[model samples]
Target: MYLQHFALTQLPFSLTPNTAFYVGLAPHQQAFEVLQTALAAGEGFIKISGEVGTGKTLLCRKLLHTAPAHWRLAYLPDPALSPMELRWALAAELGLQYSGNIDQQQLHQLLQRHLLLLAARELQVILVIDEAQALPDETLEALRLLTNLETEQRKLLQVVLFAQPELDLRLAKHQFRQLRQRISFSYRLRPMTVAEVAAYVQTRLSIAGNPQLRFSPFALNRLASGSRGIPRLVNVLAHKAMMLAYGRGQQQISWWHVRAAAKDTEDVQAEPAFIWLSAALMVVVIFGMLFWQWGPL
Candidate 1:
């Protein structure tokens, strides 16, 4: 809706984990580097945890895109499946054909044979699981057993988990110790800093075909504050603010629009005093313009 008003070619703040909007800020870049290094070194298990809306899925997609050609990737976006279902899913990803009557032992043997075949071709198998915190204990234990498929010289399969902070708490349980211990490399994704948020907004706007147009400095500050430096929240507020500005036929988003959008957002609330200040500032600007146009000579 705001695209036509702002001269933007596309919606810049979509919540989809689009790699095109990826900002490569410090934390995300560091996590990418760690993932690349661990995967290259053939680490059996690697964990990356972050708060909700901290770009875990984006990073997961990025890893899929950037992984080396020698690596075969199996992505498990839903971990709600039972242990047997998990095996079937993995087998399917590896292109293993199976009959519905196949038992658990038969499935395991099929997966093992497929993995060995891939290994013989000098291909490394990598399993990536998202929302790993929801994985049932039995499923997690089953994953641990899968990781056990390896040669005497090295592991045949590497597993990478992307999850929210709750995964850490889950892993702290004694039952998960074995899985935790196998994680040779791990990274925690953090939210953007205020400065990073500003840059992130500008970068997205520029990518959307608006290099000169921008949120005013005050508006940017308010957005960063209200979003708590979270990139997803920043995107939401900024997108809403742009829509508000478009509704009023404005090119630059002012602090007033940002404050209003923040109030409208369920997760964000601006101080009443600040809202009054924004209104006062708008009045002053309007008065200043009128005085310059028609004041006493």
Candidate 2:
């Protein structure tokens, strides 16, 4: 709604994980490097886990778009598949064509054949699974078994998983020991620091063609504090704060805008103690201005 007021080419703080808005913050950059190195080394299974809104899906997309020409990537945005369904999905990703009446054993043979064929053609086949935390126990083991098709030097099929921290918890159990052991490389994505969030917001604004949008120091602090460094929360608060400012025909965001936005948003932590102190300070400033205007009336 405020795009014209801000002179932005697009909405900067969209919740969608748009690659164009991606900023290579330290944690995301490190994770990307880890993924590249691991995939290049032909690792069997690589896992990346993070808390909610940590941008794992965006990182996965970045990898998909930037992989080397020799790499063939297949992406599964959902991972709640049964063992039989999982095999069929892999077979499809590998370019295997078959009728729906095929049996499980037959599908397995087809997957192995497709994997070997891809290897012979010197293509690196990678299966990227997003939201892997929902993967069934038997499906997880089935994934591990798929990596067993090797040519004595490297794996024929490689898998990369992007998931929430729950996946790590589930993998810690003894039942998943074999699957856990196959994860040759892993990375954990952390929430951005306050400074990083500032840069991230600036980067997104710049990409949206309005680098000059302004936010006061208090506004920035409230944004960081309320969002607790979560990228998704940051985007939500920032977007709403800007809209509030625009509603008042103001060119800059103040803490008041952030406060209102934070209160309206769901799942944002209730204001901490320091925020109350800040609010009190703002009240004092407002009363002080009124007194000056009316000669202490």
Candidate 3:
């Protein structure tokens, strides 16, 4: 809605993980490097765990975009399926033709054969499962079994799991220990730092065709604090602030706009009083420093 008002071609703060708006910040960059190194090494299981709204999906999409051309990728955005369904999904991804009436054993055989064929062609098959914490225990085990389909040198099917922090807790349980142990590389994505938040906002705006425009410095600070450095929250607050500024016919987003927008967000509303208190403290500190430096009695 604020696109035209902001002289932009598209929404800058959309929740969807648009790779076009991807900011290669430290956390995300490191995650990318880890993924690249792990996949290149032919690691069996790779896991990336992040808090909700920490850009796990975005990172996933970025990885897909940058993966080598020779790699065959299968993405599973939903992991609610049973083991049989999981096998069928993998089979479908690998372009295996099978009758619907086929049983579990047939499905497994078909998947194995397909993996072997892909490996023979010197192609790396990667199965990326998002929301992996939602997968049933049986399904996870089934995935582990799938990784067993390997050649003498390396794994045939590499699995990269992207999930919320709960997935780590799930993996901690004794029931999932076997599957967890197979993870050769894992990265925990952290929330953006305040500096990172500022950079992230600017990066998104620039990508949306607003390279010269920016959130005011104070507004950027407020947004970073209010968003608690979560990219999703930052996007939510920034987008709302932009819309509010547009409605007011203002060109610049101010701290007040960010505060109002933060109030409307569920996760960010927990520290309303603290936010104002912090703002007041900052003002007092600035005034005191100025008085000490330049006051005359």
Clashes of each: 0, 0, 0
After superposing candidate 1, which stretches have Cα over 4 Å from the reference?
269-297
What are the runs in model 2 whose C-alpha is more than 4 Å off?
278-297
Which candidate has the highest lDDT of all?
A: 2
Clashes of 2: 0
Decide which is better by TM-score, 1 or 2: 2
| lDDT value, candidate 2, whole model | 0.91
TM accuracy, model 2: 0.93
Q: Give the number of the best model, judged by TM-score.
A: 2
- Lowest lDDT sum, 10 consecutive residues, model 2, at 87-96
lDDT of 2 by residue, 2-62 (tens): 9999898899999999999889999999999999999999999999999999899899999
The residue pairs in collision within model 2 are: none
Q: Using lDDT, rank the candidates from best to worst.
A: 2, 3, 1
Better of 1 and 3 by lDDT: 3
